[model samples]
Target: MGNSKLYKGSLSTIILKLLSEADKMYGYEITQKVKELTKGELQITEGALYPALHKLEAEGVLEVEVARVDNRLRKYYKLTEKGKEETVSKLKELQDYIANMQVLFNPKFGLES
Candidate 1:
């Protein structure tokens, strides 16, 4: 949950994009993958991760599968067909946000002087 505020709004989109790339992933795995991808700069805490996951599940954007692995039950999540479509939309939205932020903060590239 490092810098949680900075990442709060994008959590679901991040999860959806990850599930879109992978066949399935468990909660802990998702956290680790994000840490690895971000070089440990960002951490997804359970408090934030689970609620977003559940919301996506409730929205029919995700499917869950439970399996017993090493004597422990693990819940894996994958994207539904609707989630696949939503991932594209979310990605585009994120990209647009980034571009706008860059222009806003880096005035040399902005239209206004």
Candidate 2:
């Protein structure tokens, strides 16, 4: 469950990064994309995902468009210019964090000495 918690904290960044590349996507699509990319290692739950998306939209990092598809209203999310900037910055931050973790995990290179 430790890995799951890590994914939860970074889920917003993941979703934003995916949308940045894909232009626009809906909730299920975002979840599926993450699953496919991670080969089922990571799964984003609706309970965790939708709230983050709503927050991003409210924070102006995402723009939403509603369209009728097969008699159902589907909301699509796309990044704004601010969102694109944030995506780049967030990705860099996440990369740095991962690198730091790697150092800790690699005994030969870690701060253990």
Candidate 3:
């Protein structure tokens, strides 16, 4: 399995969380932020990122703004009101998942009878 496969399920959540904090971001900015936060361990490819962004926009969770930058149109994404609410839910879910995974993967965690 490739590195991206590990983070495939959490892509939308990650994007949402970032937008919640940053208010707005372009595609490349999102990718770079993720890379910076993860210390280069994870990279979001265009193939994965655009589709996810489009889906969220369709779902009314994200709002898009287009601006001309350096002779090109740059699309920026920000969380809608619904997305802000969803961000809190998704973050709680992610935290619970991490805690569960820790218990399952760590041999010394909750192993005593």
Candidate 4:
């Protein structure tokens, strides 16, 4: 993948959250969405993105639907019930991680050392 550790760690969670919001999205759409959302700050390559999608699909948290669009088959991914639950959990974890980082980096958050 060769992406940053932070992005690699949260990639699946990001995909889950996006799918949870969009109902379904194809691979390229997900990439573009991320770029748009991030104001071009982040760009996800296929090499990194597909593996995460495949892993999530294999985990039974995501389902794929293949449809013919303009005479070509496109695979759209959506969150399953388990995926929905996982999304919530992942978001919570990310939030907690951010909070912990804040506490660690900011001297005066909620505790005194």
Candidate 5:
């Protein structure tokens, strides 16, 4: 992402949100998908992607499958039942956060606080 500070906190949410929509995705696929979805505004690196995946997998929010593709073994990640529930909760949290930021930035929305 161009301004990574703004995206860092939400990286996990972004990944979860994408996996929720896609049945399964590998690390590289997730990176490319984010780039495509954001029209290249966001680019996820191996440095960032794997750690997040590993964390989610460790949490039992994601499960991994290994399969041979061409000559190489690839690992694909899919959300677990817990992950589905987490996705919904995270999405709501992110949406509310964004809306609050928007209203805070645009005074026309009239932030009471």
Candidate 6:
């Protein structure tokens, strides 16, 4: 529970990357996928997840489709063309950031020269 807070920052990036891999996905599906992929290291809360989804949708980076499933309305999100391009750049940016963080966190392993 305590360690969960540490993952808060990466949630958006994670969600974006996941949506990039395919066409679209639903809220519960995203949560389940993240849990399965991370082996429980990250559990996205509804509060955090929905807000990010809404923000992305509002930003026009994502397209939303509402459909009836099991007699209930389900909203699915898919990346727009812009989102596809953005995903590539965002992933590269995130990769570099993580690499730098690794070097900073493990000074002994980083190049001294």
Write one digit per residue (lDDT tens) for candidate 2, span 1-113.
Answer: 32378898898899889998897999999989988888888888889889999999998999999999999999999999999999999999999998788887895666654
Q: How many residue pairs clash in each candidate?
A: 0, 0, 0, 0, 0, 0
lDDT of 5 by residue, 23-61 (tens): 999999999999998999999889988999999999999
Compute the lDDT of residue 46 as modeled in candidate 3.
Answer: 90
The numbered model that scores best in lDDT is 1
- Per residue, candidate 1 scores C-alpha lDDT tens digits across 2-103 of 766769899999999999889999999999999999999998989999999999999999999999999999999999999999999999999999888989
Per-residue C-alpha lDDT of model 6 across residues 7-83, encoded as one tens digit per residue: 77767678889998878899999998998887887778788899988988888778999999999999999999887
Candidate 6 structure, TM-score to reference: 0.87
Across residues 1-113, which tens digit of lDDT does each residue of candidate 3 receive?
Answer: 33456598999999999999997999999999999988888888899999999999999999999999999999999999999999999999999988778888985765752
- When sorted by lDDT, best at the front, the candidate numbers are 1, 4, 5, 3, 2, 6
List per-prediction Cα lDDT, in the order shown. 0.93, 0.90, 0.91, 0.92, 0.92, 0.84
* Stronger candidate by lDDT (1 vs 6): 1
Judging by TM-score, tell me the better candidate of 3 and 5. Answer: 5
In model 3, what are the clashing residue pairs, if there are any?
none
> Order the candidates by TM-score, highest first — what do you get?
4, 5, 1, 2, 3, 6
* TM-score of structure candidate 1: 0.92
Better of 1 and 5 by TM-score: 5
Off by over 4 Å in 3: 107-113
The reply for model 2, stretches above 4 Å from the true place, is 1-3, 107-113
Residue 34 displacement in candidate 5 (angstroms):
0.5
The alpha-carbon lDDT assigned to residue 91 of candidate 4 equals 96
Specify the poorest-scoring 10-residue window by lDDT in model 6: 1-10
Clashing pairs for predicted structure model 1, backbone only: none
